[model samples]
Target: MSRVFVKKASYDNLDQLIAEIFTLYDINLRGKRVLIKPNMLGAFPPEHGNCTDPRLVAAVVREVRKQTDRIWVGDNPMRVQAGGGVDDSARISGIYEASQGYYVNVGAKARVISIGSEIIAQMPVSEYFLEADAIINLPKAKTHMIAGITCCVKNMFGAVVGSAKAKIHYDAGHAKRFTQFLVDLYKYFKPTLNIVEALTIMEGDGPTHGKIREGGKIIAGTSGVEVDAVVASMMGFQLNRLKFLQLASQAGLGECDLGKIEVVGDFEPWPNFELPSTYSGRPMDNIQVAQAAEIHEVWGQVGRLHPRFIEENCTACGSCAEICPAGAIALDPYPVVDEAKCVSCFCCAEVCPEAALVMPKEEAQTLFLRLNPQIREG
Candidate 1:
C-alpha cells in the first residue's frame, strides 16, 4: 500500500518537519543530481497562495543539501515561452532567493518527445527533468479551474516547457480531454517525491485567481497520485470526480483508493472547504450530465473566454505575442489581438507576467452563450 504522511506545519518552522519527512520517505540523493521542482505558477507572491511558499522550498533545499550538493531548483512558470526566462516569476514569488543560489532557468532548454497521447502526439519537455537523477515535486494545495484540484499529480505539468502547454490545451479542446492529457504526461515524468504546501491554500477559481484559505498542513508521499488522493480527500472532494486522479489510478500509476492506501499522522477533511466553481457533485459516469456540467461550468464558459488587455498594465514585453500559438496577438506598441485568428485558448493571458491580459467572467459567459445558443446558461 502506498503511504501518505500529513503533518501540521507552518512556514516559520518547516526545517524539522521537512527533515523528518525526508527520513520517513528514505529520499536518498547522495552523489546524485537532484532537481527541486516547485509550483511557480506566475508572479504571484507567497501571501497570495498562488505558488509554493518560499520558506517551505528553503527548508527542502536545506534537507537536500545534507544529501547532495549537486542540486538544482527550477520550474517553468505559466508566463514562460520557448527561449524565455522564468527568473521574473521566480524572483517575484521569492523562490529565487529561497532556492539559495541553486535556481536554474529550466525553461531555457527542452527536448521534444512523442508522448503518444490521443490529444497530443509529441511535446517539448524541459531538459532539467531528463537530467535529474531525482525530482522532488513541491506543489501548492489549490483548486484548479479546469482540473478540480491542483496538487501533487497536476503539478508535474511544468515538465512541458513553454508555449507547448497552451498548444496542449488548445489541442485537447475540452476539460475531460485536457485532464486525460495531464494523466498521460504524468505517467511519463513521475517525480521521486511529492510534497504539498498546504499552509495557505487557494479556493474557488484557482491555479491562478482565487481566494486564499488557511490549511496549516504539509503532506508528503512518494507517489504523486497517492499524495493527490490524500489531498483531494482532505480538501473534501470525492476523488472520482477529479478526472486526472481517476485516469491516473486506472492507468496503474498509483493507488487512488483511500482504503488501500495507508495514511500517517493526524488527518481530517477540512470543514466546508470551498471547491472550484467548475466542480460538480454529481457522479461522473453520466456522460450527458458530465458534458452539460463541463459546458455550463468549465469548458464552455472558461474555454471561450478571450483575453482582455489592460493597457495601463501592458509593458509591451511581447510575451503574450511571443507565446500565442495562433499568432493572434501582436505588439502594436501596446499589443493588440486579432480576434479572428485567436482560438480562445487563453495562452496569451497565461503567459502575460504583467497581468495585462485578463478574462472577464461576464464577457466570457456572454460570448460562450452567443456562440452556442443551444446550451443555456445555468
Candidate 2:
C-alpha cells in the first residue's frame, strides 16, 4: 500500500515538521545525492501563491542536508536571459538562507545528458538531477490553465529546460497528450519522494493565474502517482479526469487508487471553489483570424482578454513584457499586447499585482464554452 503524510506547521516549526514527514516515509539521506525540484515557474513571490513555497523547499532541503552530504535544489524557470541563462537561483537561495542551508543553481551546474526518444526525442536534463541518488519533488498544489492541474508530475516539466517546454506545448495540443508526456517524463526519471505544498492552494485559472486558497497542510509520499492523485482529489477533481494520473496508471508507473493507498496524519477536506472552465470560445485556427478581429471577437463578442490598464495599480514595472512567452506584450506606452501574438497563457496577468490585467466574465465563460462546450450548461 502507498503511504502519504499530511501535516500542518508554520515555518518556525518547519524543521521538526519536515523531519516527521521524512520519518513517516522512512527516507534515508545519508551519503545520498538529493535533488529538490520546486515550482519556480517565475520569480513571483510566495504570497502570490503562484510558485512553490520557499519555506517548504527550505525545510525539506535543510532536513535532507542534515543527513546527506550532497544537496542541489532548483527549477528551470520559463523565462531565460539571452545566451541561455536561467537565473532564479538567487530567489531559491533566499529560501535556503532561512533554513541555513546552501542553495545552488542546477541550471549553471547542469550537464546535458541524453533523454532518449520516448518523450520529446533527445533533450538535456540537469546533471545534478541525473546524477542524484535521491530526487524529492516539491510541487505547489494549484489549478493550471493548460493541463488542468500542476502537481508533482507536472512540476518535473521544468527539468526539460529552455524552448523544449514551449515546443512540447505546441506538439501536444490536447490535454491528454500533454498528460501522456508528463507520464513519459516520470517513467524516464523517477523521483525518490513526492512532496506537495497544499497549504496555500490556488483556485480558478492557475499554475499562475488564480486566487490563493489556503488549506493549511502538507503532503508527502514516495509514489508520485499516489501523491498527485491525493492532491487532485483535495482540489475536488477525480483521479481519472486528471489525464496525467490516468496516463501514469496506464503506464504502470504508480498506483492512482486512493482507496488502496494508506493515509497518515490529518486528511482534512477543503471547501469547493470555482475554477475557470477551459477557455474554448475561440477557434484554434488563430492563423485565420487577424489580431484585431480576434481581439474584437474574443473581447467584443466572445470576450476573452479584456485587457485593462489600472494606472493606480499599474507599476509600469515591465513584468508583463518579460513574462509574455509570445512577445505579445511590449512595454513602451504602458504595455501594449498584440492580441494576435497572445496565447492567452495569462502569465502577465498572474505576475501583475497592480490588477492592471483583467479578463471579463462573459469573455471567460464564452471562451471556456467554445473550448469545452461539452461541459454541460447547468
Candidate 3:
C-alpha cells in the first residue's frame, strides 16, 4: 500500500507542513538531482488558485537546500496571453521569484520517446525532465475540463513541450484514450514525490480559470496515483469517475483502492466543491480499445458543450486557435470553431487569457434535460 501524508496548513506555515511530511517518511533529498515541477499553467496569480503557490514551492526549495544544492525548478506553461512566455507566467505566479531564478523552461528542448499508447505512440519529452534523478511534483488542486481534476497525473503533461501536447489531444480524440495516455506517460516519466497545494483551489472550471475555494490542506506522498486519488476524493469525486485514476490503477501503476491506501493525516471531503459542468459522475468500465473508440464517437452528444467565443473579451491574439488540439478553431481575423471537427475538449478555454471563451448555460442544459450536473458549467 502506498502512503499519503496530508496535513491541514495555511500558505504562511507551508514549510512546517512540508517538514512534517519529511519527518513521517524516508524521502531522501541528500545529494540528489532534484527537479521540481510546479503547476505553472499561465500568468495567473496564486490567489486565483489557477497556479501553484510560489510560497509553497519556496518552502520545498528550502527543505531540499538543507539536503542538497543540485536543484532545478521548472515547467512548460501554456502561452495563455500575447507576449507572455513561461518566464512571464512563472513571474506572475510567483514561482520565478520563489525558485530564486532557478526556474528553467525545461520544454525548450525535447527528445522523442515511445509512450506505447495506441493514440499517442510517442512524444518529444523535455530532456531535462528525463535526466532528473529525483523529481518533486508540485501540483495545485483544481478541476480540469477534460480530466475531471488536474493534480499529479494531469500535471505531467508539461513533460511534453510545445505544440506536441495539442497533437496528442488530437490523436487521442477521446477522454478515455487521453487519460490512458496520461497514465502511460506517468508510468514512463514519473516523479520521486508528490506534494499538493490545496490551501486554495480552483473549484468550478479550472486548470487555468475558475473560482477560488479555500481547502486549507497540504498533501504529500510517494505515489502520484495515490496522491491524485486522495485529491479527487477531497474534491468530492468518486474514484471511478476520474478516468486517469482508473486507467492508472488498471495499468498496474498504483492503487486507487481507498481501503489499501495509507493516509497520514486528517481526511475529509471539501464541502460542496463544484465539479466541471460536463463531469459525469458515472463510473468508467474497463478500457477496451474498441469500446473507447465507440464511446468517442457518441460521448459529446449528451452535453454538446463546446466553448463559444465572446468577441468582447477576445484580443485576436490567436493563442486559442493555435492551442486547439483538433485544429477545429481557426482565425477568421477572430477565432471560430468548426463544430464538425471539434471534440469539445475545451483546451481553447484553458489557453484563453482574455476569458473570451464561454459555454452557454442554455446549451449545456436543455429544457428537458440538465445535460450538466448544475445550472452552469463554468
Per-candidate clashes come to 0, 9, 0
Question: How large is the C-alpha RMSD of every model relative to the true structure?
Answer: 5.0, 6.6, 5.1
lDDT of 3 by residue, 1-378 (tens): 789877888878988878777767677988788899998888877666788999889999988788888888989865633336877788888898999757788877789988676768788888888888888899999987667788998888888886677778778877777878888888777888889988888876676767788888998888999999888888877676566777798888788877778887878889877775445332132111212222334456653457878999888988888888777888988998898888877778878887798654344323113322222231
Give every collision pair in model 1: none
Better of 1 and 2 by TM-score: 1
Q: What is the lDDT of residue 138 in candidate 2?
A: 86
Q: Is candidate 1 or candidate 2 better by lDDT?
A: 1
**What is the descending lDDT order?**
1, 3, 2
lDDT of 3: 0.76
Query: Could you tell me how far off, in angstroms, the CA of residue 331 lies in candidate 3 after the best superposition?
Result: 2.6
lDDT of each: 0.78, 0.65, 0.76
Poorest 10 consecutive residues of model 2 by lDDT? Answer: 285-294
Candidate 2 residue 174 Cα shift, in angstroms, is: 4.2
lDDT (10s digit) by residue, model 2, range 24-70: 77888898777888877665566777777888887887788778757
Q: CA lDDT of 356 in candidate 2? A: 76
Best candidate, TM-score: 3
Compare the candidates by lDDT and give the number of the best one.
1
Structure candidate 3, residue pairs in collision: none
| Candidate 2 global CA lDDT score | 0.65
